[model samples]
Target: MQFDRDRFRFGIEAEYLLADKATFRPLWHNDVTFAELHNLMEAIPFDDLPSMDGLELEPPHRKLMPYVVEGYHVPNPDFSPIDILPKGVEIRTPVCSSIGECLECLKTLHDRLEAALSGSGYTLVSLSHHPTEHHFEGPQNKRRYDFWQWAMEVMTTCGPDINVSLPRELNDPIDVADLHRKVNYYSPALAALSLASPIYRGKLWKIRGTVGKSIRTYRRSVIAPAIELHPEENGRMEFKLFEATNRLEDYHAFFLLWLTLLLDEGLKGRSRDQSRIYDLGAVARFGLEAETVRERAGEVFAQAPVVLNRHGFDAGPLNIMKKRLETGRLPADDIIDYFDETGSLEDVLKTRTGLIHGTELAQDSSVNAAALSRSRQSMTGI
Candidate 1:
């Protein structure tokens, strides 16, 4: 089978916290809001995604609403991974042939979401962890156990899954496994670039101190899967190490870097899962400040240009990661600094990532529930 580069698709699913616009606290009793958002999202038209002959998407989940309600789950011996309680919302992009298309799709979904929430007293925030409010639990199964902590972890953390699906012609298991292994090896260094969860347990981690770049990453160490390959055939490789970032361009950079790594045959660096897990723990604490992580990340950043160039991809997107590595800084640094300067978590939350705010939102007279409904009906044939 001849592999056509155009057949490769890019997609993303980003999870965000729903917060009270005024108080900046996690918004509770949000099912109605989520339902409304999902309905509006469903109204958006999705194109018939490019597909290969004789291949089908095993789950066909991408065809659903672009925005989905996300929940937290605890493992049970009887029904493990089944019991889930809603905690946040996720924005998923339609699979597209180019990173730019994926970015635009994400932006459209985000804008619609923002328009819906403009006057509703709620706002979507992109962050790895919620600033306040713990003790999250469902009505039943409040039993104390090691597994219950897993649900708590999910409730508190939010992030994005950067997905890359290979062309069906190239879906070789050996090649897929190699890509998975390479992604796992470099997960720690790549994760360090977007560490934004500086708050933990309802306070600045270490109380205005820089103990680590991300408290969330430190907690998820080895317990959670950092990367996943889905569908029995023509699998989509999803890298889950990135924290939620405000800028879509940051996501573009990360996606391009993943693609570069996927295509780079010359880069031979690899590591055992155990070593990668250990490095992730260190990165959680020190981020790029960790000498080992910085060195490894530096090497990857240096090689990215070569791979991107060879593959006919523009190398400009990498400047974000390059700058972070150069300065030993991550998004967490900015969050921590802002909190220190203002002494108000609400002020920090007010800083926009992808959502509209203030007068700009007031001027968005075009998007509304009815408009979305009419649009949804028109696009149903898609």
Candidate 2:
């Protein structure tokens, strides 16, 4: 069962808060919106995605995709979980053979979805939590959306779920029981880098009324099974640590970081301390700079390239990630700064979160060039 080479494919599934662009309020996904989603998936064409695939719609009119994802999970344009207030929908990409293709296809998916919602007076915002409003609504699915929404509400006031997945069995780097252990152990740093929820339910959640600086960390953030985990022949690891982000490059950078680790001799080379889990609340509130024990997981992420290049794998992607690591800046830092200056969570989203422009997404020379360029463009206006 240990036969391996680096030939594997990857994909991404990201969800967004469906909100009114002008008001930044979550919108309900009813029958009409469902119909619109179906038509839009059909009418919208992807100029960049190689698939340019024709969509196949599932029953109940809640899902759309050109194909199934390796006979697993709902393909992108998924609209399941038909009940909940402050509705959210997910767009997932079928697995791709390379990081470049995965990211480009994901960007194309975002563009197609954005264009479809253009006339609907609603825009999909990719923040982890609804900035200014409280949500308690969903479709008519009594058991799935309604019951769970109510259940979750009673626990921590109210919350939204948005996250991305990385395949544990993809190709290399980490695998088997150790892969699971490393993933579980690194949840803190991963969550830190993925932080996007600075405001929660109309309040600055990074600080408490009396406890000084605090994070509104959701209860489900501890890599709990309830949030979800699926281990297929070709499986994926779902991390609930990150808030949703629309920028394809952010996904690109993250996966690049993953790639570096994969080629590193150090990942599968050592036995890590299983008890080294850091505080999720701390990482969520302070991304990148969040303190994690270097021996536990930080060294693996930071030194992936240095050790990896010595092993002969491409170090390009690793270097790219290291550059960002050098900056020590994260999306949450900018988000909180904007929130503090504007005094409006809605304004912070409008200014910081981006809706990827199609052509601008194609500036390809090298994966490194496109990624570096996109990273710069992603942060410019902010």
- Name every residue pair that clashes in candidate 2: 76-92, 83-145, 84-137, 84-138, 85-137, 85-138
> Residue by residue across 37-77, what tens digits does model 2's lDDT show?
55666666543344423234545445456321110111223
> In candidate 1, which residue pairs clash?
212-285
For all predicted structures, in order, the TM-scores are 0.79, 0.67
Q: Largest TM-score belongs to which candidate?
A: 1
- Candidate topping lDDT: 1
Residue 64, model 2, lDDT: 56
lDDT of each residue in 202-287, candidate 1, tens digit only:
56886244455788788787677778877753477788888888776688778867776676666677867787788888888888
